[model samples]
Target: MSDFTQRFLFDDFDARGELVTLEGSYRHVLAKHPYPEPVAQLLGELLGAAALLIGTVKFDGLLVLQARSTGAVPLLMVECSSAGELRGIARYHAEQIGDAQSLGELMPNGDLAITIDPANGQRYQGIVALDGANLADCLSTYFATSEQLPTRFWLFADGQRACGLLLQQLPVDRQKDPEARAASWEHVVTLADTLTAEELLSLDSETLLYRLYHEEAVRLFEPRALQFRCSCSRERSARALVSLGREDADQLLAEQGGTVVIDCQFCNQRYPFDAADIAQLFAGGGVEPASDTRH
Candidate 1:
């Protein structure tokens, strides 16, 4: 099935949810990096989480989920645009990653940061300690602590595909009994917890929702397409070089035999700059003329 995210509301309860399954886009991300099995699985989970979280907010730029630690896996990050394009990368010490399965084992002393950057506005960020056994648990902790909302997440991934389900309780209406709203939230979350990883990866959204909430009044929205796309470009790379300043850029060119090479970690695309290119960039001439060769 095509990669997509489905949003659903519980008509009879004060809650909302999102389900995301990523196949083609997930595979495309894996194709760009040779991550170890454990690391690959973690990246997949983050990718799914990024998609679900991005769908829950309104922004025109990018949403980034990052985990940093001092354990075997030092850093794992995923970026998703408002347009549904996704990309991810993980950094780890291969020797230290042998067979580590849980979040604590893979990223001990870690912290998770979620950043929301709009195309035109101030960025917002929330940082939470990685205090749970898994990525899903850590994320749930984030919502509960930062947003003061009861939220839960089920995330699973193999090297091939990634899937996630997010459930959050909406604000209770003043006229409604608070006890009843709390009960409804607990009931639905209990049902969602019974979902197996196999079913999440294999079942479509409609069938999956029916299997979990067949008795409840649920409304499912149209699926939003998710794609694998990297925001990296020749122009962005040039700006990076320009940031290095004229002296540093010239020194790098001299050290690398008159051509500086920069490779994007997200896509492995190479951007090469010679003396002419560096001069043009430092001269304030935006990214080498269109005629400039790009690889």
Candidate 2:
């Protein structure tokens, strides 16, 4: 499949891994706005990492990867849901972002945030300083420090598509001996380190797996499909308007020249409401406002 995530288990290494290859979803996010190459690639890698992170957890809500800075790029965010919906956006200053390639350069003094908001449980978040050379290094450090797990991530993106592969050493393993388990982990991680961005981005999932670990026994699970689906709707935007109450809504409406407009940053979809529509929405009988507008 073109856009999917696959989970696998290592028979001998006692470790598990995840691979995600994104095309349609990545292109759809890019189509929403004009992004420079560095910003676009950064968003893609975040999308890949978000997808892999979703697969690693058992949650019914959303997982977000975000980095905000006062430097060149103000905001870089990507999110994926339990149902495999993916969306991302990046806001950057073109003049300040010239020729800067590293994450540190793109976002100085930035904080990388991984947020897990579950539908029925309390939300959890991990924050780290974005001082690494690349996004992958930052994520690897995050996992090492936070989860205390030996997780290695390989993320890549071209203007066309984005891809990511994650190799994690499962906490509980078949190898009982400590030294042998460490050795196994090292062997698998060492082989995984040989993976290049080209091979990870171009090759198919099974082909790439075989090429990387043809000698090892690996079990590939069913792939989960992912798509670019925006959660914005007229109804939801109307509820937001409801919260503004009548007076504020009227003032905002006047400022907006008649209709109140709310734009979805992820998909750039517009939801507009006029006077009558706002009155109906506040009257407890919601009315159809207007069709969505995309720029």
Candidate 3:
């Protein structure tokens, strides 16, 4: 009812659109870290984009949006699961964050990667230069350069709530005439481009869609609910300890006062690995049968 993604079809044209709004989930991700205003807003945009991806891409597993850079913001990542779970994080250099406004300014020379890890199929990845004026334009550039669909994204976030609208041109379907398809696509995107960030962040899916495409034939589909859920768990943490090998695990356990704490950066959930737990993990016991402890 609150955090949701909806897909709509332009009944008269060969195009479709995705709408996503986030409030509770966005706040949850923001609460996990002391992210600066810019970083938080950027992360919110990524989260919105990730949810929109879920609506547009028919995948059964996980989809990740990552932008890596060596500038003020070293990393910005968002994960969306088919089951409607979402999580995101951002790492930034404190000294350089105050003046950076745009994505390029915050993460100069960054590469945006879209990774699809299906539950049963091969993983797919697409990388593009993050050089557009905004996140939406950046994604629009990616879709345009990749020769996929003619897709344009309108992403907005104010560190409190995040929302986005994505309009993509599909292959010749209902509107068989190439010229008609082009005209329809142009009309839809032009109307969408008239949208403001405030309107996007404030309006509901139905109102916004009507405001933009009221004259066009559009069918709004039922929205899929989304929530903030970290994939980290005690078992996953134990596996990380096992990867360190016995000697290193033991050394870490000693360094952390007999308990090696592995914190989930996305959610700040802590997993403590004591000596016995580490021993059992390294002894091939599998996850070390014990109660879970997290903060």
Q: Quick one: best lDDT, which candidate?
A: 1
User: How far is 201's C-alpha from truth in model 1 (Å)?
Assistant: 0.5
Distance (Å) between predicted and true CA of 140, model 1? 0.3
Candidate 2's C-alpha runs over 4 A off are 290-295
Q: Candidates' lDDT values, in order? A: 0.90, 0.89, 0.89
lDDT of each residue in 73-151, candidate 2, tens digit only? 9899988999999999999999999889878888998988999999889999999788887888889989989866788
Candidate 1 C-alpha error for residue 184, in Å: 0.1
Clashes of each: 0, 0, 0
Question: Ten consecutive residues with minimal summed lDDT in candidate 3?
Answer: 286-295
> For model 1, where is the 10-residue window of minimal lDDT?
286-295
Residues 117-223, candidate 1: write the lDDT tens digits: 99999999999898797899999989888856788999999999899999988887531998888889889999999999999999999999999999998999999
lDDT score, candidate 3, position 40: 91
Reference-based TM-score of each model:
0.96, 0.96, 0.95
In model 3, where do residues sit more than 4 Å from their true spots?
Answer: 288-295
